[model samples]
Target: MTQPKVTLVVSPRERFSYTRASLESIYANTDYPFDLVFVDVCSPESVQTYLKATSQSFKILRTDHYLSPNQARNVGLRYVLDHTDSQYVVFIENDVVVKRGWLTRLVNCAAETNASVVGPLTCIGNPAHQVIHNAGGQCYIKTDFKNGQARRRIKQSAYLTGRAVADVRDQLHRTPCDYVEFHCMLVRTDTFAMTGLLDEGMLATREHIDFCFMVAQTGGEIYNEREAVVTTDTLGLASNKAGLMARFGQLKLPDFQWSDLPYFMLRWSDRWDRASLDHLRQKWNLAEDKYFTKRYAGLGSRRHELLIQPIVQYLTFGKGSPWLEKLLISLERPFNNYWFNRYAQRFEQS
Candidate 1:
């Protein structure tokens, strides 16, 4: 069997452990032939400095300015489509590293399954118990404050993440999801060209969902390989307050309200989910709620206020249940003090 040629597209801004680790892992373990394409969106000079020390077969495309995630990906796709004649293109966020034998596993799965797009498991690990992160994108359901407080079960997977291998297989047997995460996604060059690049409108969040939606609309199958693992290098920037705000603030609400709210919540759950925010001592600024609240405010002064207050309640205090309202009124000062300290700590660190 001929070795499949893969082009690895990396969009890097600043550097981190996963950046260097990804390159090193690929250089050391790749059995099939592959070329690396580095899209340096910001501070290409910094990346070039690091690249100077390595002798890998890579093409560094430096831009004077930074491209948003979606744009950078599109740029990388164009470069791969134009420069490399490789059969398959693998898109890995700068922070992700492929495990040993990862490419062999993905390629074998793709060939045998004839899947248009394939992805490996994404996990955070320590051998104690590596928790799965992004196995594939799943439907996101934005629960109401009451619903959340009730502690009802919601769709856990962004697509199909932490389920056992059998559960994942069963879901796949039923229907392919909207799309998998871009990180560690494998695509056939032809299918990629046919579907086209990611939607620049999204910029970052939900872009993958939009892309996958198109691919599935065109009758392409996206597969998740259980055995293959890729580690996501969120880098230090994930903790950056300004970066987080910019990423979340720029997210435009989808056209359909209830239809897309689930996915919207999924993509931005890091910022919007109450449980997630409380755990991190983070504040999402409740922008989404504010938007929806204002949009439907015309319903009536009292009625509109009542309708949107659920979201407001979530924003002000990291709780969404009606019980949280009572809890807030009873313990406002203490809760405020706690959040005040947390806010100060986050700000000071930033």
Candidate 2:
């Protein structure tokens, strides 16, 4: 049987430190033939050198300025659409590692089910195959009427989050799901005819849910292919220094270099998060309820936990107090805002 032509477009997730491992894993594990288009947006010199060295093996798209996750994906997606006649385009983040037969399974599932999109069982952290990050889930807008006001809320849920993969292995199968994450997703190229390019307005978060919602709205079928598996090394509670220390003897944790701070900070900045949330709400007419309020309150939580806590722990000799961490984060918040604003200016100028 002839295999369908697949083009895998890899874009940065949150950091550039995992580029080597993630790219190597894809080439090492995936047996099926596919074209690769890597989008590199302002990655550090080390990562740039690595991609340069490997350029002959795949197409590398570089940008001098940093781009949001969806923007990067769209950069590669547009290239694929304009240049290639591939049937399927898989959007895989730069931090994800694939297992053997992963691509084959995703292709087979899409072929068998005629699924417009397919996602694998994505696991997280060390012992990469054991812990579940997301095994398909729900994402939709819900509406409630109160005081003659129609309140619309965006509802999202991940199945079996943090569960051991072994525990739910038997229950897993290729099935329809409301949404799957962009950490690793196989999308039929023709589906773009209906959904168009990824919405760049989803700058910092919820881009996956927004894209999946758009697909569903366009009568596209999305499936979760259980047999195909991939793991992201930088999610959940396991990405911090303490988590790394706890699992020290295992595989070396992907480093979040000091240079990664600028892009990382801007990527999860409060301004970007608020902008993304506001855009999503306005685009979908979602109401500002508890869901949105909670998100608004925790806009800086990701940068705090991932960037600040690690520095605090190092400075306090692993005994960083909550107050000290909070104080440090307070001191750092302005710098983050400045950096993001500067970045936005640069983007606008470009």
Candidate closest to the true structure, highest lDDT: 2
Candidate 2 at residue 177, lDDT?
Answer: 92
- Residue pairs with clashing backbones, model 1: 95-233, 137-158, 137-159, 138-158, 138-159, 140-262
Error of 1 at 296 (Å): 14
In terms of TM-score, how similar is model 1 to the real structure? 0.58
Candidate 1 structure lDDT:
0.56
Candidate 1: which stretches are off by over 4 Å? 13-18, 44-46, 125-129, 137-156, 159-177, 234-350
lDDT of 2 by residue, 1-350 (tens): 77899999999888888899899999999999999999999899999999999999999999988899999999999999999999999999998988999999999999999999999999988768788888899887888899998898878888888899889878678878999999999999999999999999999988888899899999999999988999986543475755333244432223657677788888889998999999988999998888788999998998888767776666666787899888988888898899888888887988
For model 2 the local lDDT of residue 27 reads 98
Could you tell me how far off, in angstroms, the CA of residue 242 lies in candidate 1 after the best superposition?
22
Candidate 2: worst-modelled 10 consecutive residues by lDDT: 244-253
